[model samples]
Target: MCLQIRDIKSKVIYCSAVLLAVMLGLGTRAYGDQLPHFVSVHFGDAIWAGMIYLAFRVLLTRHPLWLSLVLSLCFSFGIEFSQLYQADWIIHVRSTTAGGLVLGQGFLWIDLVRYTAGILFCYVIDQILQY
Candidate 1:
C-alpha cells in the first residue's frame, strides 16, 4: 500500500536534496567543457531530470512515491515535447542563458532515455533511503 508523508523531518530532508540537486546540476553545466565529451553532453540532462525528481519530492512530500515518480516523468517529458513548438517568442526565450538551460534548445531521443534513467535512479535511491 502507498502511504503519504507529511512530516517536518521528511520535508527538510527532501528540501535539502532538492537544493543539492540544483547545485550539482548547475555545476555540471558550468564545467561541462572540462569533462569528457560523453559525460558533458549527456550528464547535464540526466542531472536536470534528477533535479526534477528531487524537486518533486519537495513539492509532493505528502504524496506517495509512485505519484512523485509519475508526475516527474510527465513534467520532464512535457518540457522536452514542448520544444517541438518553435514560436518566435519561445525561440527567443530559448536563446537566453536561463531559458536555454530550462527549456533546452532542441530535442533528442537520447534525452528521453537520459531523463528516464535519471528519474528512475533517483526514485530507486529514494525508496531505499526512505524505507
Candidate 2:
C-alpha cells in the first residue's frame, strides 16, 4: 500500500513538473521585460520543481540514484536549450538579467553541474529526513 501511494505521488510529481515546464516556457515569452520579477520567481520555482522531482525519484521510488540525477540534469539542460525558440517576446525576456541568469544565454556546461548539484542536494535532504 505504501509503495502504491508513493507511485501515485511520483506520477503526480512528474506530470506537474511537465505542466510547469510548459507554463514557464510560455510565461517567459508572455511577460517579457514588463515583469522581470516574475521571471526570477518562475526561475526559482523551476529549480525547486526540479529538486522535488529528484527527491521523488530517490526517496519515493526504487529508481537508481545516479539515473535520477542524470534525468533531472538532462531535463533542465533540455529546457535551457529549448529557450532558443525565435519568439521576439522570448528574446526580449532573455535580454533581462533574470532571464539571462535563469534561462541562460546559450548552452553552458555548468548548468549540467548545477542540475547535478540540485539533485544531490535533494538526495541528501531526503536521506536526512528519512533518518
Candidate 3:
C-alpha cells in the first residue's frame, strides 16, 4: 500500500509537470494578441498546482502537510509578485516569442484569485489521484 501510494503520488507530480508545461506553452502562444484574463488565471492556477505537487514530493518527508502547503502558497505568490521587478533582462526576454507569452507584464488582482483557484484544484486533483 505504501509503495502504491508513492507511485500514485509520483504520477500526480508527473501530471502536474505536464500540465504546467502545457499551460505555460499555451500562454506563450496566446500572450501578445489580446488573450483573455482566464488565460492568466489558468497560468496562475497551474503555478500553484505544480508547486503543490512539487512540494509534496520534495518536502513531505521532512515537513508537515500544512507547512508544505504554506510553503507552496508562498512560492506561488512570490513568483507572481516578483514579476513587478520589470528588469531590463526580463523585458528583453519577454520580448522574445516564448518569453513574452509566459512572463506576464504587470500584476493583476485576478491573478491572485487564479492562484487560489489553482491551489484548490491541486488539492482536488491530488485527492482524486490518491485513491
Candidate 4:
C-alpha cells in the first residue's frame, strides 16, 4: 500500500541520517588528533554523542524524543564507564582501530558533559525539523 511505502521511505531516510552522523563522527575523530588539544579532545566526544543519539533514533523510530535522548545518554555513558575495565581481551580489543573507537582508551568526566551537549543538540535539531 502507499502508506506502507511511505513508512518504509521515512525509515530509510532516518537510517541514512544515522549512518551519515556515524560516518561524520568517525571522520572527525580520525582527523581530530591533529588539531589543537582542546578541539581534538572535546569535539570527538560531542560528535560521538550525536552519533549515539542518531543510533537511538534508528532503533526506536516511534519512541518519544525524551526517551530517545535518555536511551542515548545511558548508552553513551555506559560505553564511557565500560572503559574502566581493562581486562586482557578488552584491552586487546581496544588496541585495534575499530575497538578503540567504540571502547575508547580511557575514562574522562569531561566526556560526559560532551555527550550531554551532543544529545541536547540532536534533540533540538529533531524538534526544529518537526515544525
Return the TM-score for each candidate structure.
0.90, 0.43, 0.57, 0.86
Local distance difference test scores for all models: 0.86, 0.60, 0.61, 0.83
Name the regions of candidate 1 deviating beyond 4 angstroms.
1-6
Error of 2 at 82 (Å): 2.4
Q: In model 3, which range of ten residues has the least summed lDDT?
A: 57-66
lDDT of 2 at 17: 56
Minimum summed lDDT over a 10-residue window in model 4 is located at: 4-13
Clashing pairs in 2: none
Model 3: per-residue Cα lDDT over 1-131, one tens digit each: 99768767665765666566556646645582565765643663555445554555454633444554566667667766867878899878877866644555667667666766666666566557657
- On TM-score, the candidate that comes out on top is 1
What order do you get sorting by lDDT, best first?
1, 4, 3, 2
**lDDT (Cα, tens digit) per residue for candidate 2, span 1-131:** 99888778766765665466556655656665666775543444345445545544735366755566666666676766666575888778879977864665665555555555555665565556546
Candidate 2 local accuracy as lDDT? 0.60
On a 0 to 100 scale, what is the lDDT of residue 126 in model 4? 84
Runs in model 3 deviating more than 4 A are 1-68
Candidate 2, residue 120: lDDT: 65
Q: List runs of model 2 lying over 4 Å from the truth.
A: 5-46, 55-60, 85-113
* lDDT for predicted candidate 1 compared with the true structure: 0.86
As a whole number from 0 to 100, the lDDT of residue 23 in candidate 4 is: 76
lDDT score for residue 35 of model 2: 65
Model 1 residue-pair collision total:
0
Which candidate, 2 or 4, would have the higher TM-score against the true structure? 4
